[model samples]
Target: MTAIDTPNGMAEGTLDGSMAEFFKAQTRSSAPVMVNVRTLKRFPTAGCARLEATLIQDGVPTQQGSAIPFVIRYEINLCRDGRPPTEGIDLDAASRVLPR
Candidate 1:
């Protein structure tokens, strides 16, 4: 799969501040967290880019025994104006994605 770039054009896969705030609100956590962006694609025809990111919350111990913690799939779209298509993730929305 093609790695996604952050809104700031960083290849490190970290989400922007506003998006991070949105995620935090959704997750209801003030704990330190890290979002691993899996892919980012732009479609000139659609005039937007689809972003896929994974949310990881810190200090949440799981019973998997040193395994990965809870990982939630988050999808967001950046319009031609470089703003989120919506206030937050909506499962009903069809995210415009490029084939990996």
Candidate 2:
């Protein structure tokens, strides 16, 4: 599934033209971003899991300086009925900005 977290909100599944524009408008520059997994937990039910991670954007440009950095904390819920060859995995994600 295609999932992306934008500054305005989260965009999931097949993105449309408007969503693409929103992403471009929100993220004007191509800043290097990295996803760092903080925790992973599996549910009692098979093929179910949850992940918590942070998206780090380093060396962001700002009016005061050009080295500003920020982090966005997010959680992803994933589940699948069978293996990849036969089944598909579903993903749902949400995110929030962490205070600097």
Candidate 3:
């Protein structure tokens, strides 16, 4: 996976487990999250696609009387193969916090 514009800068290659850890820390104090898919483009590979989405943290107002929710924009390359029980999936993603 290749992560660009991450909090810690760009990272490349297999993510192993660090990606989970990164997001876990990022959302540690946020409300329940929801993903809104903005776009999807299939790749030439049988089970691969590019996805763009917004991660919205509901119920978290940005201001005293505002209705804006916290949001993060991200794009990812996703691939899956094999059957469910033994299927393998890979992700290459980049994310950044969007300005309110």
Instruction: TM-score each candidate.
Output: 0.42, 0.45, 0.43
Q: Write the per-residue lDDT of candidate 2 for residues 4-23, one digit (tens) a residue.
A: 12232323232236544454
Quick one: best lDDT, which candidate? 1
In the range 3-35, model 3's lDDT, one tens digit per residue, is 222333233332225553465356553344554
CA-lDDT, candidates in order: 0.55, 0.46, 0.46
Worst 10 residues of 2 by lDDT: 1-10
lDDT at residue 40 of model 1 (Cα atoms)? 62
The number of clashing residue pairs in each candidate reads 1, 0, 0
For candidate 1, the per-residue lDDT at 18 reads: 80
Q: Residue 4 of candidate 1: its Cα lDDT?
A: 32
Predicted candidate 1 versus true structure: per-residue lDDT over 41-88, tens digit per residue:
665534456777676765444455443345677776666566655534
Answer with 1 or 2, whichever has the higher TM-score. Answer: 2
